[model samples]
Target: MDLQAQIEREGFPPGTSVIPLAEPGGQLFRATQDGGTRGLELLLTNEAVRMYGAGPSLALVLSRLRERAERGLPPALAPGVYERQVFVGD
Candidate 1:
């Protein structure tokens, strides 16, 4: 999917920024706002270790994250690069 288009449709709060990470053989993204006080590390994968293999769609995840940002909530996950195995099921 086109990540940038999804981000625009997600309507993140003003100043919010989402960027795709250049992780070889993996899909990863980062979202940040308020000068980085609030952020999320999003990893897109169809498999995870010790957990359900599939996670939510990228559009769905972006929508939820946008909702949280609109409500002034911190990211559900801490901001940073993370191993793919760390994420659980959507």
Candidate 2:
């Protein structure tokens, strides 16, 4: 299934944003909250979707989104590939 479909199927929590990166072979997704710039790295796999948010900043992604929603703001981010990490097996 396509990345977007898979994500929709999984039913990511409200206020969560999933942006597919321009890479293949274990596709990476930039998950942001509250239309923020920095997003957590989401690794998609056949079995499950893994989030690589180990630190405090990364952990705040969902929280930030919730705050945005509470304030009646849309949780949308600019559409673009976040190239902070090098894509392997591309």
Which candidate has the top score in lDDT?
1
lDDT of 1: 0.59
Best by TM-score: 1
lDDT tens readout by residue for model 2, 4-79? 5654554456766666654454545566655565345544432222334233322343344334434544333345
Model 1, position 13: C-alpha lDDT score: 80
- Tell me the tens digit of each residue's lDDT in model 1 across 1-86: 46677678777889988776755544666677777666766665544322433224565556666776677746435444322222
Error (Å) of candidate 2 at residue 32 is 0.6
Stretches > 4 Å off in candidate 1: 48-56, 73-90
